[model samples]
Target: MSLLPNTMRAVAATGSVPLDDERALADVDLPLPELRPRDVLVEVAAVSVNPVDVKTRMRRPADAPRIVLGYDAAGTVVGVGSEVTLFAPGDEVYHAGVITRQGTNAEFHAVDERLVGRKPANLSMAEAAAMPLTTITAWESLFDRFRLDASSGGTLLAVAAAGGVGSILTQLAATLTGVSVIGTASRPETRDWVRGMGAAHVVDHHGDLAAAVREIAPDGIDRVFTPSTAGRLPLYADVLRPFGEIVAIDEDPDMDARVLKSKSIAWLWESMFTRGVFETPDMIRQHELLDEASAMFEDGRLRSTLAREIAGIDAAGLREAHALVASGRSIGKVVLVR
Candidate 1:
């Protein structure tokens, strides 16, 4: 702690502007964040950009203070709070920080130890950084929302299976449970990528989703996982069996729940930030799940979805990364490294 610096370099959203605008993100100097009772300070080595970063930047008010925006990070512990127990100085870790705090796009960051995990031995910082947020989201969707397990036998339809969360979700379902996975991807490359991740089938989302899914699973799907629910609930209802479930991560203002009433289909939302944001008693589950995922990664049962890496945690690089992610076509995850 005595060797720690007072200030650190960071990248932040200076104003709510388009990704191409120079004012969208900028380099800044920030004081080292204060550690809370259960907090640990980390020296960040790599961070991955998600869709949340782009959304936050675009939706932020012009008068709001410059806010740093990043979530997924892989780094080394450098300092610990009085109540911290899970990590010590020099321990390498990875985490997807809560949305309530300033983020991980900095030289140093402070995060709750309950949200951190030991970095997988086989992964580089960039690769590990690409995992935390997507991994948590996907894991919760399958295990917590859908309640699938090793004994569970069914068919799962994963929309956008080549995206960050979908890539890991497909792998987890295929490897950890008895379910068969049908992934949706429009492009040839992404379809191949989804299949490589362990999907039993890959269908074109640009075509008739219900018909395509029916051709593969004639009996109807047992579960559906999607990032977006805009204007697609009816199609999901049509393809899901009676008493099936749908887990989604995005917000859709026009979504109607009545479509599933007749079939008794359950529609659930999965937000990895819920436990941390509310300081729920079960917040520590994130730590446990991440450690479990680490073991899976180390044993070769899971793999990193890092598709692109940019050098340095600077505003220019982050802007490029953010724009790529905002394009809605980038496969897997994009990371920035020091």
Candidate 2:
């Protein structure tokens, strides 16, 4: 009954290399669904490249020579494993995958029912493709990492707000929490984008971030949500209020973060894949978060971060997108549309 190929085309990492200076993709054959009882076979139409994809592919686990390379995806379900209750054949869905599994940089993918969510009705596959990775990261940082309460008033700053997760996180802070949002974007256009997404203010990350934030908030920032680990510690130290929290989702070994202790500030690192990787008792929390996010999108409280759409689901396109993201110049999420 499946009208799908047995072997899917995936962009694989032939060898390891640094994302900035090397070729990570070498096209290859990846085994398609042979289906599990609770899986959904999705025909991927659009996918987004994240830093994780760039890093994992660049570090090609020499042992496993055929790892597919994407996480965020938007597609239509083509086949349903017997016990799939939330979706059926012909449903449109989007999700960021489990870190331990094969990814969405393929023609087709098989995923668990618990990890997928309905694509936003107002968005295209490319638009919806941008939400999952950002959503998961922001949600984890705000609610879990910082332990901020939605009913309490707080002030937060997002360093590098024009990036993928920061864009969405800005809006999430506005609508979900009782927090005043100050987003940092150096460029004029990016600053506008951050403010349009409901940020109370936009500070230039190019200037002294601490100084810019102080000119605007004068007192101090209660929390700093950083989607990048680049240049965070030094810039934030001066503006963080006592007991302020800092959360970063990027993988950077350069961060010691211990200096924050002098101010009684807390530093937190977030990774959404933690639930799926370890099958945490709250493994199903993603399902709940996606449901809530969907409602936010439906109610007009949340917006898609999709910025650029690249055609084709091939190695060349992915390489280009990865290069841009690795370059640290992109203003928002980029999607590879099939």
Q: How well is each residue in 16-89 modelled by candidate 2, as lDDT tens digits?
A: 66443334576777778566786888899999988777677667654456667688999999998889899988
Q: How close is every model to the real structure, measured as TM-score?
A: 0.99, 0.92
Candidate 1 ranges beyond 4 A from true positions: none
lDDT of 1 at 237: 97
Point to the candidate with the largest TM-score.
1
Q: Any residue pairs clashing in model 2, and if so which?
A: none
Scored by lDDT, model 1 comes in at 0.94
Question: In candidate 2, which residue ranges exceed 4 Å CA deviation?
Answer: 18-23, 61-64
